[model samples]
Target: MNIPNLLSTMRLILSPTIIWLFLRDQTLMGYIIFGLAALTDILDGFIARKYNVRTKLGTVLDPLADKVLALSVLFTLAMKEIIPYWIPGILAVKEMIMVAGGLFLWNKGVVIPANIFGKVATASTYAAVLGSYVDRTIGLYGLILTVALSIVALFSYGRIFFKEKV
Candidate 1:
């Protein structure tokens, strides 16, 4: 297993730990788990490039893990009302659209690479979620950053999709 892929796998493994800790009302511990998980995300990409050990499985697993984690965090936030109810609704729509695009591309044998915008969006989201978990002091800024990144990421992704396969 490549180092980057290994780090991604660890993030996947930590997702459940974060959920468990958060559900148990252990906010501080949950933040710790989330921090470590987020760190793994940062390390994975770095190691992937530095060691030049990228793989197809990593391509698939990494995004799926991100979606899973995002959904989990969003669910918790919605329940806590830290985010508006429609936030999840819109996010779900976005994910579904992306998944459909990915499936279409995969079926056509076009290996649509993971764009950097998507990575920025994911990192921003994790930061916002973790910020909310820790304290609302920085959470507002985190959310602001997340919204900016998501807009750029999704817009860029849409541009690529429309340009290449539309």
Candidate 2:
């Protein structure tokens, strides 16, 4: 309902459309839509923080939107042979582990916020996705960088949540 949440919702809605375009070989349109969705991601966070209209819904929807957008594009590109499977595979596994870890922590009444490493990984993934349209080499390097950052993020989150318990 709020502006921030609405923006997040827009990104969510746009995810499948972007994927559809990509799968259909509409690279330009896919990239444009993806860029717009990314813009919404930035705007939603800024608006939520600046206008003090942050909501729990926004908190949940924003990350969900980000995951859907990033993963969808990656999968589509991999399917089209535009990017290697290993890249999305690594990113996907990292995300799965992170989600499982988050759930475990939540069950134990711990809340771990997204850290800088995760943000860096996400930004790298976005770059990789965009770069695929320009040059596969750029995309490949970006994905490699993202995978590295994701590993660090996994370790960072694990350290944060498991340090006290272990």
Top-lDDT candidate index:
2
123-152: candidate 1 lDDT, tens digit per residue:
878888877766765765676677667777
Question: What TM-score would candidate 1 get against the native?
Answer: 0.87
TM-score of each: 0.87, 0.90
Model 2 has a clash total of 0
Q: Write the per-residue lDDT of candidate 2 for residues 10-114, one digit (tens) a residue.
A: 999999999888888888999999988988988988898899997755766787788889988888888999888887788788778877876787677665666
Model 2 residue 70 CA deviation (Å) reads 0.8
Q: After superposition, how far is residue 134 of candidate 2 from its true place, in Å?
A: 1.1
Off by over 4 Å in 2: 163-166
lDDT of 2 at 97: 82
Q: Please list the residue runs of candidate 1 whose C-alpha ends up more than 4 Å from where it truly belongs after superposition.
A: none
Q: Clashing residue pairs in candidate 1, if any?
A: none
Q: Candidate 1 overall Cα lDDT vs. reference?
A: 0.76
